[model samples]
Target: MEASKVIHAIYNDDDVLMHAVKKVKAAKHHIEEIYTPFPVHGLDKAMGLAPTRLAICAFMYGCVGLTVAILMMNFIMIEDWPQDIGGKPSFSYLENMPAFVPIMFELTVFFAAHLMVITFYLRSKMWPFKKAENPDPRTTDDHFLMEIPVHGNQQELHDLLAQTGAVEINVVDKAH
Candidate 1:
């Protein structure tokens, strides 16, 4: 496959980067991606990204965890082996639900957290021992990098990025 030309505009401050994103979008330029040292609030809205459905997935996972906890506790305490504790030999799951609240809460949180991490990894196509795709390492520390495809308008893009307070601009040929 052939390599595609892209522009990497580096910014030192996130405020400037946010403004630059707005300007780039206003100029009808398609921003391929942006990298930052930390999570920048509202960056997704600025980039016009669609809302993520991860929250829904988390809720579902929590429900699944709750269900599992209830079933396991019921089977252990009621059906499999009925234990007479605290002078209550009723052997009913509903009566003993209060004692299992903490367990259910912990399992719910555990499932939501672990499943969300796995979902995010799969969604991002990330796995153990994978190669990094970042164009610049400074973005992982103190810099912000904005990537825009170069469609034979390098000069215009460079000028626009310069006006947006980019500290440096480099044309990169990225291989797919």
Candidate 2:
């Protein structure tokens, strides 16, 4: 198979890059990817990307954390060793649930946050010791990069990107 050609359009400003994305989508071109120096509001919607389901995963993780908290508190306070917590020897998990409320809340937040981070990293194919996939290093600091696949109309695409105020344009063979 032949190597695929791509155009990397660099933008100095996020507003210009956003406008360019709209124009490119209006022209029915497929944008492969975009890299921005910072998070741009509404960029995902502009790119027509599906909403992420990470929130659902977070909710599930929170539920697991809550369950674990309940079971752990029950085992430690009621089953394994019943203690006189807060001058009340309520040897019942349900009776002492009010005291454990803070613990449950903390554990739920902790699990949701940590699990979401791990899930995001795994989903993005990022792992410890993995090389970066950024096409240009400037995108991490002061530039935005838009990657568009070349489909035998490089000149037209270049013209369009130039019209959209791209600071620089590069044609590269994308390595898989």
Q: Count the backbone clashes (under 3 Å) in each candidate.
A: 0, 0
> In terms of TM-score, how similar is model 1 to the real structure?
0.97
lDDT of each: 0.95, 0.95
Q: What's the residue-level lDDT of 26 in candidate 2?
A: 97
Clashes of 2: 0
- In model 1, the worst 10-residue window by lDDT is 88-97
Backbone clash pairs for candidate 2 read: none
lDDT of 1 by residue, 1-176 (tens): 99999999999999999999999999999999999999999999999999999999999999999998989888888899998888887478888788889999999999999999999999999999999988899999999999999999999999999999999999999988
Each prediction's TM-score versus the true structure: 0.97, 0.96
Q: Write the per-residue lDDT of candidate 2 for residues 1-176, one digit (tens) a residue.
A: 56899999999999999999999999999999999989999899999999999999999999999999889988988999888856988578878888899999999999999999999999999999999999999999999999999989999999999999999999999966
